[model samples]
Target: MANTKSAKKAVRQIARRTAINRQRRSKMRTFIRKVEEAISTGDQSAAKSALAAAEPILMRAAQKGIVHKNNASRKVSRLSSRVAALGKQA
Candidate 1:
């Protein structure tokens, strides 16, 4: 239990921040999933567009400390490669 007033305020702030972070994480996942879905369908142009939309969201998540910067970069790189391969295959 947070007995001190400051402690209670801190708890409230934590709850608010947690909610915001959770929303951001969920949104980021949604964007990533869109790219994955596009890739799985084997539509090169759609995958490229989806990756374009997702890239900024992923970068923003990293910038905001929701995800590690290198992790985000790796994801972007991997997805870009997969999308590029689709073009090569077609």
Candidate 2:
């Protein structure tokens, strides 16, 4: 479909970027899932540690444009609260 040389190169670049972005998105989700799993188990220490690890990954994804800034902040806020509540329960 790309008749021009420049267009073909652009397509290749897009494909490469798409692969990289997909990897980043998958990794970010994995980190989030870890936090959720820890929360679900109601392990305060584990949940707190998982949240600490996930927070930076989420923020990095937002910084790299994988997710929105507010979206990352909202997730961090909610997870932090849940982790805190686990503490209160004990």
Candidate 3:
């Protein structure tokens, strides 16, 4: 549908960015889920470890523009607080 060469190039670039962004979103979700799972199982150590693994990935997602920084920070904050609370609750 892109008759102009420039339009075709733009389409190609969009596709590439979309694919990359999708992968980043999926990975971020997976990491967050892992942290949540660790917390749910009531293992403070595992929850802490999972948080350690996920925090940087979330931050990197923000830095790469895949997600907003405040959104990322909020998620990280909530997750960290939840994980921290596991220690007290246990």
Candidate 4:
């Protein structure tokens, strides 16, 4: 219903931003899942490497506002713990 010109413009901007943010968030999820999958498979070295790769991507996501800082930190913390647990279990 965005009757105002400004309002309609905003809607278009939001749609474009949504697509970009969704892509960022999806990439973050993929990295996180890769780390988790490595952990699940009991590959300590691969898990460690995957966590390394995921960490920076996540931090970038936080900086870009695609993901909240605290949420990203929590995810990193939990993923780190899980990676550590994989080592312990081995």
Candidate 5:
């Protein structure tokens, strides 16, 4: 239990921050899923476009501390490579 006033304020702040971070994470996942769906359907253009839309969101999430920067960059790299491969296939 937070006994002191300061401690109670910190707990409230943490709760608010947690909700915000959770929402951000969920949004990031949604964008990533869009890219994956496009890739799975073998639609190179759609996949590329989805990746374009998702890239900023992913990077922003990293910048906002929702995810580590390398983790976000790695995801972008892998997704972009898959999208590129899709182009080669067609």
Candidate 6:
């Protein structure tokens, strides 16, 4: 569909970028899932540690433009709060 050489190159670049971004996004979700699983099991320490690990991945995805910055911050905040509440539940 891209008749121009530049357009063809642009399509290739977009495909590459899309693949990279999709990988990053999937990785971020995996990290988030780890945190959630820890939370659901009510293991405060594990939840805390998982959240610790997930925070950076989420932020990095946002930094790389895979997700919105505020979205990342909000997820971190919510997870932090949930982990904090685990302390009181014990």
**Leading candidate by lDDT:** 5
Output the lDDT of residue 68, model 6: 96
Lowest lDDT 10-mer window, candidate 1?
81-90
Instruction: Report, for all candidates in order, the number of backbone clashes.
Output: 0, 0, 0, 0, 0, 0
Q: Across residues 44-86, which tens digit of lDDT does each residue of candidate 2 receive?
A: 9999999999999999999999999999999999999999999
The RMSD of every model to the true structure, in order and in angstroms, is 0.5, 0.7, 0.7, 1.2, 0.4, 0.5
lDDT score, candidate 4, position 28: 94
**lDDT score at residue 78, model 2, on the 0-100 scale:** 96
**Candidate 6 lDDT tens digits, 1-90:** 999999999999999999999999999999999999999999999999999999999999999999899999999999999999999989
Stretches of candidate 5 off by over 4 Å are: none
Q: Which tens-of-lDDT digit does each residue in 1-90 have in candidate 4?
A: 899999999999999999999999999999999998998889999999999999999999999998899999999999999888987877
**Candidate 1: stretches off by over 4 Å:** none
Clashing pairs in 4: none
What is the lDDT for 40 in model 4? Answer: 81
List clashing residue pairs in candidate 1.
none
Tens-place lDDT digits, model 3, residues 1-90: 999999999999999999999999999999999999998899999999999999999999999998999999999999999988987876
Which segments of model 2 are wrong by more than 4 Å? none
lDDT of 4: 0.94
Give the worst 10-residue stretch by lDDT in candidate 4.
81-90
TM-score of candidate 2 on Cα atoms, chains taken together: 0.96
TM per prediction:
0.98, 0.96, 0.97, 0.90, 0.98, 0.98
Per-residue error at 5 for model 1, in Å?
0.7
**How much is the lDDT of residue 83 in candidate 4?**
88
Tens-place lDDT per residue, model 5, 1-90, is: 999999999999999999999999999999999999999999998999999999999999999999999999999999999999998988
Cα lDDT tens digits, model 1, 3-59, are: 999999999999999999999999999999999999999999899999999999999
Model 6 worst lDDT run, 10 consecutive residues: 81-90
Looking at model 2, which ten-residue stretch has the lowest summed lDDT? 19-28
